[model samples]
Target: MPLLESLVKRRKNREPLSYITGKAEFFKRQFSVDERVLIPRPESEQLVAQTINYVRKLGIEHPRIADIGTGSGAIAISIALEMPSAEVFATDISSEALKVAQMNAHKLGAEVEFTQGNLMGTLQGKFDLIVSNPPYIQSQVIKSLEPEVLREPRIALDGGPNGTEVISPLLEEIRKKLKPSYSAAYVEIDPPIADIALKTAQAKFSYAEVSILTDLAGLIRCISIENN
Candidate 1:
């Protein structure tokens, strides 16, 4: 089959458009993506934007930043490129996804330290900022999703029961990684259970403030946690 024909066939067979094109964009920058990682979505841009703004407001020169579950290196790489002074790290549970993320960091010429481990497992020491866009879809909802979305890796979508399986645990792990004060985490959350995720984060960081942020659609899109 001709190359374009093969590409069209793949899309017709329900391959994600990003996988077919071998690219996805976040924060106005393009990235290479495949079955190993989740496609970067526009709504996630809100997380990135808010993080950058918070970092600037904090005015902490050379802030240490980490991107949890940084599939495709979208969030980490973008922030590294945007904040030349900040040290950046990215982690993923899938080695394959890390390979793609590393490749993207090189292609984009962004300096991001990469680690392979589940959630906060590979991380040590404190970071001034941490951000993530983890799996948030309930198992049952995932089963009923469109074939196009289903084409993505299940690990990147399955949030287990109540859609808080990953997010809830991650909040506790995140609190431990933070720098205690003036540290914050920006998390991209699915709207369906944003409240649940925020509550969990707050519970984990009782001294911290967890706020829900909305995207242009006025739907819950992110949870910002700042430890005052």
Candidate 2:
């Protein structure tokens, strides 16, 4: 009864349920979470599954993977836990967020190297798989989101004027660095701007097979890239 009351109080105050609970479940594992890091969403789990399958198809027994803007190390750690043979690394500009991610990694016993840098700039190698759930919410619509969402860090949500600002440039860098033929990049995108994701990826990775993957709701949720 006390737990239920506390949850009700949190929702009434607009504190995110995940924040109040101090954890979130992703890819079937409990990950410590707080305001310091963006709460992992079920939608992002698809990025992990997609990446695993795509890389496996490439026959990479020990693939290298980088999760850009790894807020709570949910995606990166989850991938690491599942693909024991794979090498996983995560990057985040926020030192606080990195700390939270590191704690979760340690608690979950997943070995994911964390780096402090914006996007993929800090990463040093051409990974067999690169993935991200970059900030894709347009500035104008930020305040219009649910009060619970507003409580999360804006840096993890604001995607600039059109919601694809971060994604565009990130794709550009990935285009130049993705290992030819055997490498791929997966990006979680806003449904409304799925077209922008596809266009940017196609423009940057002209020779890659870029596809818009839909979530269970039948809404476009991710962009998958494979070097052709």
Candidate 3:
């Protein structure tokens, strides 16, 4: 009963239940999470599902996959576990977040290579699939977030003046890192920025198939760019 009271006290303080429990479920698996990382969301699981579906559809026996801004290793580990034949790599700018990601990967027994870097800047070679759930929240709006969300690491939320700060640079870098043929990138974004995200993706990959994907709620949630 005392422990329950302590949990209730933490909840009253607006701390995320995931943080208090030290775990968050994603893609039907549990991942370790804390203040150092953003809790994995359901929308990101859709991103992973799409990636896996694409890889299977392409019939790639051994695809090279990269997950950027891999908070808590949710997306990376999920993909790695589902598609064990694929070579999975995950990157994050924060070493602290990477530690959480690494721990999750280790605990989940998912074979993922975790690296500390900004987006895809540190990854080498081309990837068959590039996925990211980056910081797309407007910097000014972050302060207005719910208390539980505010407790998440600020660096994992701030996206400069506009919501596309990190998304813009990430798309720019992907052009060089993504395979020229039979490759795609899936980036999660807030619904409000769907138009901007679509435009940015189309501008970056004019010859490729660029489109906005909606989540279960029918709200725009991801921008998908497929190379021809």
Q: Which candidate achieves the best TM-score against the true structure?
A: 3
Q: After superposition, how far is residue 61 of candidate 1 from its true place, in Å?
A: 0.4
Please give, for residues 117-193, the per-residue lDDT of candidate 2 as tens digits: 98888888788899999999999999999999999999999999899889999998787667887888899999878
Q: Report the C-alpha lDDT of model 1 over 1-228, residue by residue, as the tens digit.
A: 598899989988988888888888788888999888988888888777877888899788999999999989998999999998999999999999999999999999999999999998888899999999999998889979989898888999999989988888888888789999998999887888977887788778789888998888889888888875
Model 3's TM-score against the true structure:
0.97
In model 1, the Cα lDDT at residue 176 comes to 81
Per-model TM-score versus the true fold: 0.96, 0.95, 0.97
Looking at model 1, which ten-residue stretch has the lowest summed lDDT?
Answer: 43-52
| Candidate 3, 130-202: lDDT as tens digits | 9999999988898899999999999888887889999999999988899999999999998877888889889
Runs of candidate 2 with Cα error greater than 4 angstroms are: 1-8
The count of backbone overlaps in candidate 2 is 0
The Cα RMSD in angstroms, rounded to one decimal, for candidate 2 relative to the true structure is: 1.6
Off by over 4 Å in 1: none
Ranking by TM-score: 3, 1, 2
Candidate scoring better on lDDT of 2 and 3: 3
How many clashing residue pairs appear in each of the predictions shown?
A: 0, 0, 0
